[model samples]
Target: MPAPRKYPDELPERAVREVRTTSRPIAHVAKDLGIHKEALRGWVRQAEADAGERDDRLTAAEHEELKQLREEAAELRRANEILKAASAPFAQELDRPRTRPTRRSTA
Candidate 1:
């Protein structure tokens, strides 16, 4: 059986920076820090994901512009539908009204 594990009471703020500054393998870092290699890999993955999310958030103005454009398109479509409905009755009215034909006999 593997021996019981011991962990440091506190992790320094600069621990990651210090580890990255050196050219040592991650396994060496994990072993020297009394932690698991998989845990360090998990942290790296999470950090990359967070950076990607931050980059998306950085385009706040562009995102807002896109949202506004979508809303304007929806409004224009509704206006077009209302205009079509209003014009339909008038188009029918034009067809229904017709002058009666008149005929005059010539002498």
Candidate 2:
């Protein structure tokens, strides 16, 4: 699980908007908003990625999809392990030789 956010949900958007519209330095904006400058800078970068302004980082939607795909891959691997474990006994049985009973002559 993700750690709880230190700032409110709206703060990032507000800070990014402030920086974009006012052209103020990130440190100054962060100081005015009581936010960490690095965090605000990261938010601005993410916002730019979301807006298609940057290509170096994944967009928010792509990030979410990648997270979901990773979870799905993990789940599939777990299921495959369980299936292999469950089939092991049957596989061993199949590998063993079976003997035919000899017919008895009538006396």
Candidate 3:
């Protein structure tokens, strides 16, 4: 599970908007908003990526899709392991020889 966010959702949006529109330094904006400069910078970068302004990072939608795909792949691997374990006994049974016992005649 993800850790809880330190700042509210609106704060990042407002900070990013300020950085974009006002052309002010990130540190200054962060100081004014009481946010960590690095966090605000990351938010700006992510917003740019989401807006198609940057290509170096995954957009929010792409990130979410990638996360979901990873979870699905993990689930498939777990299910495969379960099936392999369940079939082991049947595989061993198939490997054994089927021989009939001979009856002995009394003299």
lDDT of the candidates, in the order given? 0.64, 0.98, 0.97
The C-alpha local distance difference test score for the whole of candidate 2 amounts to: 0.98
In the range 1-107, model 3's lDDT, one tens digit per residue, is: 89998999899999999999999999999999998999999999999999999999999999999999999999999999999999999999999999999989998
Candidate 2 regions with alpha-carbon error over 4 angstroms = 103-107
The model with the greater lDDT, 1 or 2, is 2
Model 1: how far is 96 from its true place, Å?
5.9
Which pairs clash in the backbone of model 2?
Answer: none
lDDT of 2 by residue, 1-107 (tens): 89998999999999999999999999999999998999999999999999999999999999999999999999999999999999999999999999999999998
lDDT of 2 at 64: 100
> Which pairs of residues clash in candidate 1, taking residues 3 or more apart in a chain or in different chains?
none
Q: Which ten contiguous residues of candidate 2 have the minimum total lDDT?
A: 4-13
The TM-score values for the models, in the order shown, are: 0.39, 0.92, 0.89
Better of 1 and 2 by TM-score: 2
Best by lDDT: 2
